[model samples]
Target: MELLKKNIHMNRQKSQAVMQVTLEEDFNVPDSKADVGSIIQDEAGVKIEDMKVANGQVMVTGAMEVEVLYVADNKERKVHRLTERLPFEEQINMEGAETGDNVQLKWDIEDLSVSLINSRKLSTRALLTFSAAVEEIYDVSAAVEIHGDGEISSLSKNLDMLQLTVQKKDILRIKDEITLASNKPNIQEVLWKSIQLRGTDIRILDGQLDVKGEFFIFVLYAGDDENGTMQWVETALPFAGTVDCSGCSPSMVDDVELSVASVSLEPRPDYDGEERILALEIVLDLDIKLYEEDKVEILEDVYSPAKELKPVTMQQVYESLVMKNFAKCRSSERVRMENNQPRMLQICHSRGDVKIDDTQVVENGLKVEGAVFADILYITSDDTLPFALMHGVVPFSHVIEVPGIDGTCRYSLKTQLEQLSTTMIDSEELEVKVGINLNALVVRVHKEDCIVDMEEAQLDMKKLAELPGIVGYIVQPGDSLWSIAKQYYTTPDRICRLNNLESEDVQAGNKLIIMKTVEITD
Candidate 1:
């Protein structure tokens, strides 16, 4: 709810008034983390004596039985092809590893492979493990080695679970203190917030405990036991009929207030894989603290798990976004100085460096170096930057697609930039932004959701010459051809194509044309 008050007080020549405002804030923390990696060891011809899953996470639990399906020890620089099948290896070693430990077992496939890759570094033994719950059930079996990693080389795969942890203790204490303070003995497990109680008759009444009033915003506290309803309060839904209550109310008292501060995510490393994090994650570390009178208390303990809200993919954020293709997404903590006046001042734009390497090159044949580009995030507001600030990143890379192939070679790509523009709001002007990204060959088909301006959509022998598609429309009351043209980025003559109108004068019911936007990717 928004509250506004207006008044005028006369001084000698001017009048002024000051108002105070209060707001509520809450903290959010990540509750889970899944990391995948590996652990390697030394051994050979080691068969799977056994395997099992011994952990519980979401849906993991029970005995896990895994078998050694394919294993091989090939040591050759040249590629080998085989169609004929061979018997599997039997009677393998399954000692040393515990019931919960992930183990790798290996065996030689072709005797000739040993000699061919004699000089190569191959893991004589390797282990493969998928995510399994603590109490999961599984079947285990022994089999011969299928593929070889050149020679006796070390290779393994493992998934590690990580629990989120806080980066700042102070922030954690503040958030916890605030949230806990707001939570009060309303009824059972459900707590009522004191700030929501609204009463104009309540200035600081006699005691600072509970405000006296014909309650305005107060919710009636009520609930049904296994039998029937008692005093029902609307704010106690989550704990209604759930928590065992004291069955008695405490003596009426006052002098307490509650509020929320901040929140964060924490992660605890459960496996070696957790050491090296991957692409996606929704975790945080928070610091919270509470204050009363002049005393302060730190509160960082989490009472419950926080569900994932918005899951972001690195691929979409990286490749799909125009920024990461040619240019990498960059971020940094920025500090600035503001004057006493409550207003924003213009500041310099942000600039950073983007390094490109070998992700685009197929092999050692083509190598390109990444270049530095100009970038600036001019946030000219107070405290927080406005979300509407213009932001565009230009990707740069040295084209390596051979010189002779005209357009055939991956030379340079057309620059694409998106922003909430501040200039040219209602003017006919073209602005150009430059950047580079990998562009595929051009393909033109019927535009899917294509934007264009045309005369009409219906097949009319009378005005077939004017209709370019559904890109045109007839002018209506309170409509200008310029706005119609801007909507399609075309001219009145172009609009004349579909509607079949002879002049600029648009009729209220006359049909006008509109163009659809074309789909392009880089």
Candidate 2:
């Protein structure tokens, strides 16, 4: 018996393995240094320099930079700064990983320890953690076809699918000089400086991407005075440019990550004294990935009328990567800066950095918990030490509003401090107001049903012979017109016409008349 057939073929990319691995490392200090001191404040910065893949493994190389400010042994304790750089190497075992695959790495400082070895030496231990993921992308194909002799019926559905197109890396640099205000003091030494991104907007053009944003540059400098007083200044540098991305369009979605690679500072040429002009050099790295949004038609279920048919089916529940924009949130905190150094002081300069420690998805939003590390330089109430600095940590929690979020969703969130300012409420309490923005890409998992295969079903001749020519039968559970027609060697349309029925929906315990017209052929 010849059968009708329909065939379809398409190419798809599937991720074979998505794995995460963590690594740790440690280092020590040398002699001739101050021993056993109380750590006033410390901060650690981690970055992944490069990644390479070899036989069955991925090699990651990176560095961790740590800065510590502490009080050493003296008649009166004073804050002293110490800095160190630790290099690390780790290998994540991926059984089928090879060159030309995609690997992502992020590192963090898990633990840090400091202890005294002797009067002149100290021992330091640090635990560093690195997480890496190796994704194997391969081609996948599926074809749906109908194979039968009689009329066939089927169902279809539409689905939104995400396809990754390009992944690349590039460098962007900013080299220019900025002049300090006339009222501010000259820069003798920089205590703390932070470069933050703000009000970033991106657009797509012909063969390129347009990026426009402003850099919030904040600097706390020690003035060249008799007591080396501290003061702070801030400026916003607006920048606009384009990056070449061949065959890019506005319809596609892109993810761009910007990071500071290196930074340098120098005194402006031919300028001296309080009329301060400083030169700055900053190098930033950009990682961009493009994705195409597509809608696909899928075949769900099928049936045949004249011929006995058996259709094969398969079900798959998959995650679609979706980019979502969350509403900006503002939080306020009050820090009490009183620690026996001075009391009831006047604030000179204040700056802080916000770090997100944890994130949890909630109903139509995200909950984040982190701390703000701030250093405030102030004028003491007494006349002994006019300029002094105090360090404090203020913890905060905020909920970012985003729609269509649930517990099963996986996401990667990027957070930034939009605005930070401080006001003196009292001699002991400082009122700090902070604004934040949380951008998220939520990967939602959706389930769909599909029909994969179909074949002609064979019937028994002995069962057909035992059936009466005209009979009355009662429909039972799980009964269909297609099945009953195939049993009596008739078509569903002919049965419906003979039984005076409008449709093929048969209910259980319903009485029906059956006529079997089978010419017995030997």
Candidate 1 lDDT (Cα, whole model)?
0.23
The digit string of per-residue lDDT tens for model 2 on 1-522 reads 322333322212222333333333333434544543555445567667778987768787776776655555654343345667767677777666678766555555554555445444444566665555543333332324454444665445666765555567776777877887767767776655656777676777778888877777766666777756666677888877788888788887776766667767665533444437777887777776666677666555455434445655555554565556755767777778656766657776566666788999878878888876667666667544444566667677877666777876766677666676778888777877777666776767665555555666654566766777777778889988766766666666767888899998989887778787554556
The lowest-lDDT stretch of 10 consecutive residues in candidate 1 is: 315-324
Distance (Å) between predicted and true CA of 25, model 1? 23
| Model 1, TM vs. native | 0.13
**Scored by CA lDDT, what does every candidate get?**
0.23, 0.64
How many pairs of residues collide in each model?
Answer: 100, 0
On TM-score, the candidate that comes out on top is: 2
Error of 1 at 298 (Å): 57
Q: Candidate 1: which stretches are off by over 4 Å?
A: 1-140, 144-345, 348-361, 364-388, 396-522
Q: What does candidate 1's lDDT look like per residue over 104-221, in tens digits?
A: 1112111111111122221121232222211111221211111222111111212111111111111112111111112322222111111121111111222221222211111111
> What is residue 166's positional error in candidate 2, in angstroms?
3.3
What's the CA RMSD of model 2 in angstroms?
Answer: 5.8
Give candidate 2 regions above 4 Å deviation. 1-42, 54-57, 68-82, 92-98, 110-127, 134-137, 144-150, 184-192, 221-232, 270-275, 306-317, 321-323, 344-358, 369-404, 447-522
